[model samples]
Target: MDDDIRRGDLVAEGEPEQEFNPGIAARLPRKTVAGGALVRDEAGRILFLEPTYKPTLDIPGGIAEYDESPYEACVREVQEEIGLALPIGPLLVVDWVPALGVWSDALAFVFDGGILDQPTIDRLVLDPSEARAHYFLTLEEAAPRLRPSMARRLARALQALTTSRPTYTDFGR
Candidate 1:
């Protein structure tokens, strides 16, 4: 099992801590579920979507329907956002947030997706209600521009995928 730590838990540079605070935790509201994809192109660039209602860029995904699994939600989200059907691989990260009083228990599935051999990203068929544009970026190029949470999440996901070890972690809980 992965180590669990509370928000305020502190550790020295060389020490490892595993205990976590279970209290002060925000419970899930009916356990909201969602999924996203870490879609990479032939040139190793990752895809990101700029949300219409939000300034931060995000992965393409939406809440999963009651009958849908996380994987199913991911496939559906990609099709809805980009009008493309691509194969999804293993789960990379499962993130949890509680401070916002919102439980975005998300599963990120990695995939060898994106327009094949296309150097330029075409305009996306984004849902105006959800996103305004889509773009591709290398990890280094996108790091500085993404929200801190998104950048950290992506880094964790990429590490998990490369190491073949899936990770599940809670935040603000």
Candidate 2:
């Protein structure tokens, strides 16, 4: 390691980047971790869900349960919410969301679900308790229907698809 490399209290030329110090870890503030999948249609339109619990539309995803990875959580959510055991691709975006009202700060991720043809789209089974309807729309048409930060992060997710690399998106809102 270079002498310029530094992280937290333990600083040395050859020190590793991550160290397991329980004392320091226990004091770290916890942020909510969420993961979702961005599924597109053959026409390249995004699949959006009208969740019963909220007014605005959302994608297929949810908060990670204890001992669950972000990718696992996203897959579980897709099955639970949309009743599809579809394949989940690589991560596209990770965003930092500020606390609003009663919610704490959060780290959210978006994964690529690849393009779904019409037949597969027709097979989606929505859980009435989670979502009422699903639709496919262009990002421009979907933007106004989502939270500003979400819209921005989603746009970044779409862009990252072309570069084939994960994007870190922060709206700072």
Candidate 3:
């Protein structure tokens, strides 16, 4: 087999090595993406979902599927997990979660879900299989229920709401 002979495969034998190799794509940074809704009730309490699959409490959201935008994923997850077709609002927080044990680094987004009325909260239809329960709590009250980074993210999201700007953070810190 000559080096110049064409053997069509993953890499062609006849092709000279180029500066930009196909392997560059694999070496490029690949980060996970997720979206969450910073839903709030009229009492200024944040809506936090107790996802059955998650060890700790999380907002109504999940990882973005292939071909789906983070906003779309957030909207879909909210409806699927909480049975609410609420119009998602502006992006509040874009948190860059650091890679943890057995977990890849991720870019997590938080969108404003605006304040829901009492009746709307009452009408929330949570699927027992997806979430065992839900809670509406102040940041102080909710911090204990979430992982430290998430608690920070939530706090930053709330701050973004007040400031009318989105925040970027390193693992929500």
Candidate 4:
């Protein structure tokens, strides 16, 4: 309505100009995505990796890289952790873990690596830098060794394996 105003102008008088600020978006909470595989031996024991950097034992997986899908990351991580290049099966579990202290919330995925043959198990290799040792342990034996969160996730994952369906958990429960 004023002489200085131009036609088709989006801003109205007395209204603050608005712009999309990436800084504000960057401040929003982001969940880290990770993928791993649940592999088993002929005796029906799950395979666990003992990471060199962490005092805790972890599954055969790692954090997903930028622009990498969860499934792809699973395959890559499995190969990196233990020199295996087997095809990864369908996703079995998706666990949303809450933030604890300095760590951020994370969405972790588990894929079915299927049962390994005796020959494959015998040929398995472990990278000393990534994994110090690998073991095949029954569910009962592995429970106490795994962190509480991982234990719950493994339980749900085993249930998924039995039911032949995918399972989801919040905070590893």
Rank all candidate structures by their lDDT, best first, as comma-separated numbers: 3, 2, 4, 1
lDDT of 4: 0.86
For candidate 1, the C-alpha RMSD (Å) to the true structure equals 11.7
Please give the lDDT score at residue 150 for candidate 3: 94
lDDT per residue (tens digit) for residues 23-138 in model 1: 32445245667778887667777888887776777777767888677777888887788776666677877776444534344434333243344633453467777777777787
Better model by lDDT: candidate 1 vs candidate 4: 4
Choose 1 or 3, whichever is better by lDDT: 3
In candidate 2, what are the lDDT values of residues 119-138, reduced to their tens digit?
88889999999999999999
For 1-173, candidate 3 gives per-residue lDDT tens digits of 23333245327545666757668876888789998999999889989888888778888988999856789889889998889899999999999998999889999999998899998998899989889999998989977778999999998999999999998999888
Q: Which residue segments of model 4 deviate by more than 4 Å? A: 1-22
Assess candidate 2 and give its TM-score to the true structure: 0.83
lDDT values, one for every candidate: 0.67, 0.87, 0.88, 0.86
Question: Which of 1 and 2 is the better model by lDDT?
Answer: 2
TM-score per model over all chains: 0.68, 0.83, 0.85, 0.85
Error of 4 at 128 (Å): 1.2
- Residue 88, candidate 4: Cα error in Å is 0.7
Off by over 4 Å in 1: 1-29, 101-116, 119-124
Q: Predict model 2's lDDT versus the native.
A: 0.87
